[model samples]
Target chain A: MVLKHIRNLKNRFSSIVSRIFRKKRDIRIGLYGPVNSGKTTLANRICMDWLGEEMGSASVVPHETREIQTKEKVQIKSNGKSLTFNLVDTPGIATKIDFEDFLKFGLKKTEAKSRAKEATRGVIEAIKWLDRMDMVLVVLDSTKDPINQVNITILGNLDARNIPLLIVSNKADVRKSSTTKIRNAFPGYDVIGISAKTGQNMKDLYGSLLKKL
Target chain B: MNLKIKFIPYEKMKMDSFSDILRDVKENTIILIDAKLKPEEESEIIEKTMESVSEKFSGIELSSIDFAGEEEMNNFERFKNIIIERIIGKKRGMTIIGPAKIIHKIKKNPKELLLYM
Candidate 1:
């Protein structure tokens, strides 16, 4: 217990020191969540709205993004205020990756196994990049229950690291989507509902990001 | 296959290296910790699990419940719980971690956990 406290204090001290001495770099805003939670979709939306280009492709298959995709110098203007940052789209994090699950999606056995390997590596990469995020947008599928282990762990780790964050309840266009449930589940955080597919409530998302940072 | 469940006290877990725990988990053992793991501890476990992932051992399914944090409490009650946890050196709850191959999903209800095998 004492060691845990000491470790936390050390991390806090180092974070403070880093903030004090850190030179001017592009503010990195990262998109992170569980697999198939629409992280890439939201990333594409943000990039398209700001940089007039899409960041990456979105897919129904899990772990479609197997690498870290970054779009630099994405500038968004709201209320006459402008903010430019490097937008990072990370592969979704997951605890399990059974190749058999992919077989249901009509992938060949060899292809599924290969994809599983890459997905595991992607999960590791996403975990490794958590420290680099200046701010994180935790994109969650609003149609699903939000009180899962993946969501809790991500939120808890970010809070422990003292990183600025905002929760995005994506897929709000779905009839079953419920932002109220998400808001209720995580009471202390700011959450905005948006459909990354149809670009619903994106203005509110941008405005919220500006206020958060 | 015979199922094995190991219950370890939080203090003992802190004393032992997590690799020892992971070794048991790799051998198809389910671990029950006396208290909810802190976020950093959970992250550390995840990192270690990723390093050990292979054809045989894919990964682990981990879930923790903080009984105190889950409840709606008045400020005084919450403060009292916090003090108690501080003195106990652990949170007031349990955590279950098992191989993902064995435990497909551990669903979280508000107050109880339902494991899907």
Candidate 2:
């Protein structure tokens, strides 16, 4: 009876010590990419998986996210290990933002100009916030050619800063998706294909994200 | 040189100005204090502008002209005319001024003006 009591006390003490020693620091994970690359969709998927909520609204219009969106303290469980991180969903990054582009999308002149200005500022703000990121997920549309100036510039900046990153080839659910193109373009970075819209191959995404962490 | 000259392409800066006159200078820079602003907000905006500049040029120093004497204003006018005359790639230019330390750097390394945007 005494041995049994001692074993129980020892187990309780070890569990308490383990909890205290566990790494509870909230890692900051930033989602970065160009406009309409499904960044928000992937962010929503991750949020829903862990927090049961969505981060921001996604739309077919370019630069829908005109500001930086953040969701904090998201705990993701993968393969029996749990990781907690603050998710930072940044506005789309673009080299040039012209108001006339929005006119084709059926927006009024005033609204288009305002959106262009806001999106331009958002690009700058996203660049400024790069210094605060612990890890980054560069989302790319698998349907599009991975060879683009925006992708190169973003990756160059990340490489210059030596930030830990993963390339997520999103929208693999589409029949025309070709993640191999992305993998070939960026051979150095880890690329994982997943359908953020339909939650396809999410297990692989979670595992890869944990590896990044 | 009383003015520490730093050249900035207008597209490189990224902030919405609260001042009325400076609003039209979007995608360009004034480099001088030509707009009217409250003294309290003046210092804040000046610092913010300089901070944005520092993000481009790490070691550069920035300064503002509170009251441009006649000669200084005349010099500014001539420089502005020259910029308007031969604008490269139609790129707008703005400059910030400082004292001895900055003047020395500009004089020593003029090529630093063409750093990446």
* Number of the predicted model whose lDDT against the real structure is largest: 1
Task: Give residue A100's error in model 2 in angstroms.
Answer: 1.5
**Model 2 TM-score (2 dp):** 0.59
Docking class of 1: medium
Q: Choose the strongest candidate by TM-score.
A: 1
Q: Where does candidate 1 clash, by residue pair? A: none
lDDT of 2 by residue, A1-213 (tens): 355356547754664554455335557789998789999999999999889999999999898998899899998888897788899999886534556768899999899877876776677677767656778999999998776545655776677556789999999999999999999877778999999999999889888888777
What fraction of the genuine interface contacts, i.e. the true contacts, does candidate 2 reproduce? 0.00
List model 1's recovered fraction of native interface contacts, to 2 decimals: 0.49
* Prediction 1 TM-score vs. true: 0.92
lDDT of each: 0.88, 0.64
Per-residue lDDT for B1-117 in model 2, tens only? 133223433233223342321332232432433321222233333333323322122112222222222123466776775575355322222234322122222221111232222
For residues A29-74, what per-residue lDDT tens digits would candidate 1 score against the true structure? Answer: 9999999999999999988887788888888988899899999999
The top-ranked prediction according to DockQ is 1
Compute each candidate's TM-score over C-alphas: 0.92, 0.59
Error of 1 at A128 (Å): 2.1
Q: What is each candidate's fraction of native interface contacts (fnat)? A: 0.49, 0.00
Pairs of residues clashing in candidate 2: none
